[model samples]
Target: MTEPTDLTPSGRLPVTIEEEMRSSYLAYAMSVIVSRALPDVRDGLKPVHRRILYAMRESGFTADKPYRKSARAVGDVMGKYHPHGDSSIYDAMVRMAQHWSMRVKLIDGQGNFGSVDGDSPAAMRYTEARLAKASSFLLDDIERDTVDFQPNYDESENEPKVLPAVFPNLLVNGAAGIAVGMATNIPTHNPGEVIDATLAMIANPAIELDELMQIIPGPDFPTGGIIMGRSGIRRAYETGRGSIPVRARAEIEEIRKDRQAIIITEIPYQVNKATLQEKIADLVRSKEIEGISDIRDESDRSGMRVVIELKRDATPDVVLNQLYRFTQLQTSFSANMLALDDGKPRTMGLKDILEAFLRFREEVILRRARFDLNKARDRGHLLVGLVLAVANIDEVIALIRAAPDAATARESLMAREWDASEVVPLLELIHDEGNVIIDGKVRLTEAQARGILELRLQRLTGLEREKIQGELGEVAQKIGELLAIIESRPRRMEVMREELLAARAEVATPRVTEISDALGDQTDESLIEPGQMVVTITRDGFIKRTPLEVFRSQNRG
Candidate 1:
């Protein structure tokens, strides 16, 4: 073998291990940030999510289409787009189908898709799925080239860089993921509220965060609960990070004579109800909490009802407060609104996120219009060629007959000049740049010439000629509208607003979590019933209390 060449051809360059590690780690972190952990501010999807939706769409698993096997979808996504594990892709698909997970579900599942109780979904083979109706908001204009696409990992397929989402899905559906050194946990909001706020921002771009908050007071979890205060919500909306306390909605009900029970109707967002009940039971058994007789889940198909039976003398309010303090029934949802904006990780406030989405939507609309405009112009150009062929029918026929072969005929047709009088208005209407008018004459392009040769003898009739003009007129009108949309910014904004409102009408539901001004961590002393008690104090610093009703009643004569 030849003498060993230098590690570097010119010189042996050395890099410290620390530097190499740092660079390698940074690359990994960025990959997770861009491809796995964070969602795009525009479409509110990470790479896996976007791929799954796109693949399902390509396979014809739309809202109107019948449900297909979940395994089939997972296989298609993994093979074509997402090269990750099947379980990860299937889990993402299941979450999108879960109503309790996504505020507006992207998938419409036909089988068991996990639960708020923290149960895992059945395997992909046992389930079925299709895109949800509201998913159309994100996928409708995709075929019109509204978004950019990039090659897959193996370059065997192409996937969208981001979806052309019409609604503010980032806020409406929320997101949660953990990357290398950073993580994001955004809370879901009411679709109606998010849409209304987006419209407000569009109408007045200068609106402050506080004004926007008026339209969207706080997050609305799928599982109905109560948000205790506004301070945390305000902080999260303004700074993109905060913790909001949520409590179970409970009521004191007298099941029998003097015994009362706490009926929990809803739990905090993301808190496992089964775990919460177990914790409550543990508290009672360990004697950490004093006032409890029994605990049982009376929840059914109608609604959730966790009944905590109280002893004869136990105060229901005091016991409820203890449960809230000790169990997951009252939990704090930590909001970290970190997302990928322009391929960079950004912790964005409410206004920043909405504005980014609006800008992206404007770009998508403009690009789609341009794509349509190009198609319309191409059609009009071909129509002009057909019109020319029909007008000079005999000359064209004679030329074709004289040619020795098809190639010669095509060249001869393109070589001659045709009168531009009849189709000049149609060309101008479509802004057809393909057909150039020079000195009151136009030369047929190879494409137009080919189209003329392909035309049948029947198209040379009077009715066919009239049909061609009518079709060209329609194409011209479409071109004009598309041009108007592309040229005017305010018109695009109007279209965005209209589309958003329509989506809101379809997906908006009542706010499940109720917001209150009262603090969640207040003492339970206020819950104690007002009464008189006899107190006895010992010299050793011990004290005891007895209800006034414990003493015998007396009458004064």
Candidate 2:
């Protein structure tokens, strides 16, 4: 037997185990940071979210169309684009549909999509969904080569790297994710405000943060609440990191002759109403809070309303303050503002994000213009061939009759030089560079010959001929416009502004969360209601508070 050659040349390089582990861990961490967790700066979506929208749009599940089963969309995304678990993909889809979760809902869900009270959404098999109308702004012009595409997991299809997001979706809807060692917690802003800020930045790239803050006051949560102060907003906008305090909107009113109750119309964003009520009840039972006699959730289709009845002598203001201190009714949203920029994690302030989006939008507009320009030029080239053939209709028909087969006639049409005097001007008008006029004569190209031979008998009529000429004229006009847009920078910016305004009309809405100047100044002592309580201590140094009624008065029992 022939000696076996060294199949594994050089074998292993003898890398240290420490080095291997370090390098492998870094690769895994980067994969999580770039591909799985962070949102893209342009489209403000993770891979799973992007895949769902693209798959739904591809499947014709749009706003105008009727809703399809959510399971269908999830399956398409998982099979075609994202190769992840169905539960994770469905969870991402469900969040896009929840109004309380997203500032501007991207999906129009037809069935139960969970609630702010921490209820779980229905299974994907039971729900139906379609792309929302506002999604058109993000998905429009996608097929016109506005963005880059790469092969899917199995190379069976291509998927867009980032959407052609016409507006700043990141700021409008916000994002939240946890990566290997970093996390993002961006707060949502008003659409109108975000658009106005973008337009303002377009008008003046050097605008300061204070001026931007004037336009965009603060985050506008879908669940309307009161922001305690503006300092946090300023700090976040300036540094990309800060905590904003939010409080539920509560009003004290007399429910009966002398019984007063606290009415909660809106809770802090992401807070569960049921959980808040339970906590209040626990506090009341433990005597840590003294005022509330009863608690009930009266929420309905109209709106949210949670009533906390006060004792006859309890002060409404103090009791409300105590509840705010101890319950989820008041919470702080910590803003991290981390996202993926150019395939790397970055911490960006407001200005950085807007600047990046503007740059990307300009690139999309340029790419789309080039694509449309190419299409128009190709169409104009075909029309030129038709105009030439119509000018020489008798010669062309006689030549076709003389040839035995269509291929022979096509070859003959390509071989002979025809008079270019009539069609030269049309070619010049469309700037066609395919066939050059030599001594006032030109030869037909393969494509042009095919277009000519494929013409119908009806097209030989005077009216049909004139219609073709008119269409050629329109295509030429479009070509000229697209060329101008491609050549001029200011003109491109103008187009961007126009498209942004159009998107604004569909996305803008009135602000929901109100910003207040009042400082949150409740102390720990004030958090406890003024009432009698029993404190218990164990040998292990554990302490607990119990209501005084736990031990009833008795005679040596």
Candidate 3:
């Protein structure tokens, strides 16, 4: 601590270069670890992602557990892995596991998080939960040295930066996160297919993004919505990013056990579960949902039970139109996935991402060649062949060194050609290849022999070397593409954009002027002039806007 006289008014202490560097670096590291890398119990946000999946396997939150309040589950997460506030924890727990809540729900919530809308939970004591099947699968290999774990803030807890998340959690469960200059928004996938794709990747890390599609297919949203087109998924993965189009499952359901009506099984992936409900409530209050007899959150522990019970004999198509007309259920997800390149974050399209990954993989291959024991052994064996030829150099020189009467060394070796025994005449009586190499005065060691062979091989500059590099590069690209795809966000609501656009365009058609060639009538888009429009909005709910044409109309009317 410097004295007040030596320090400025800001209580500054002279920091050395080392201290400055160390402090600055540590601060950055902590920022990544605490805020970005680690998951918060409140929002279920890890530095890597905000979305999470929970299991309702056995100890799962059941409607039966004496109706344990939702608060209990939230409390457990807060006290354990996450130390955020209870409200945050509860919210995360509910959102992740709620069936009727998320369009592409991650968690398999067994108990209740409250209403499908933004309603608060009954109480902390009402809900309960356990590890989910998918969650357990994701965590299975955690202790196998397949993944890394770090200490918590107080060193009292440990968290896996990644779950060994074998199933491409980013894609399977979908994730959303905001880091310093980056964000991730990956969509959820079908559990079974995700597992298959993961297994495929592990079996041959060299698989292409296109190949992965065969295994995982497109996003298998929990809400069962439609992924209009999957062609962009490959490009997105290849480029480290791309958008997907998602849409709701609009099905005609029976009303009052008689008339047919449309029932929305899934909403847009981007719309918040809480926000969607509020919009629904507002519509009901506004009497815009005239045909809706009741909108009850029938979704219980078993499955999604969003019951939009309708009035008798209402047209289901019209109801669906109304839903699209006013709600968050129809939306768009803009994908801008970014991944690590050269140890730094970089935004990329699907193809670019794949290319970067491939390059990274090639580097790995080169590194392995220099490090892996088995590879080194194979390389050393090749050098043994070269040393055999070099040891007999003396005989060749003798033929050239002497007159024409001298014997030809080529004939001697040629006689033994195509057979290992041919070298026996030149090799003394050594059973081992190395013994002969030493006896012939080559003075070769295993490591040195391997090194020389490697240099020679690298100098080949031929098709074989290219083939090897190509294999390595391909693998690297595949892995990166997989990770990026998983780490990337999915576009769930994009499919309905054209529909929404057409609707909006119709609403904004600005009554175009047309010469009804016969009548030659003129038309205006709006009843009131842009500047002459006068609005009188009332707190009691009445809204009045003065029309511009009224001023020009005859006073007699």
In order of appearance, the predictions have TM-scores of 0.93, 0.92, 0.47
lDDT of 1 by residue, 1-557 (tens): 78865377668676789999999999998898888999999999988888889998999999988999999999999999888899999999999988778888999998889877889999889999999998888899899999998898998778899999999899999999999889999999999999999999999999999899999999999887899999999999999999999999999999999999999999887788888888988899999887789989887878888999999988777788888888887889999999999999999999999999989989998999999999998898999899889999999999999999999999999999999897788788888889888999999999999999999989988999999989999999999989899999998898888888898889989888899898899576744555898787889999987777663352222
How many residue pairs clash per model? 0, 0, 46
Write down the TM-score for model 2.
0.92
Error of 1 at 193 (Å): 1.4
**Per-prediction RMSD in angstroms?**
3.4, 5.8, 17.4
Which candidate comes out best when scored by lDDT?
A: 2
Best by TM-score: 1
Candidate 1 error regions (>4 Å): 1-13, 524-557
- The TM-score-based order of candidates, best leading, equals 1, 2, 3
Q: Write candidate 2's Cα lDDT for 1-557 as tens digits.
A: 89866455677456778999999999999999988999999999999999999999999999999999999999999999999899999999999999989999999999999998889999999999999998888899999999999999999999999999999999999999999999999999999999999999989999999999999999999999999988998889988999999999999999999999999999988888888889999999998888789999999999999999999999898899988888988999998999889998999999999999999999999999999999999999999999999999999998899999999999999998999998888988998999988998999999999999999999999999999999999999999999989999888999999999999888899999999999666886665556677788999999987767654442227
Q: In order, what lDDT does every prediction score?
A: 0.90, 0.92, 0.46
Candidate 3 residue lDDT tens string, 262-369? 556566655555566667778878987767666665555564545566667565556665665566554445555544443345555433433443333233323333
Inter-residue clash pairs, candidate 1: none
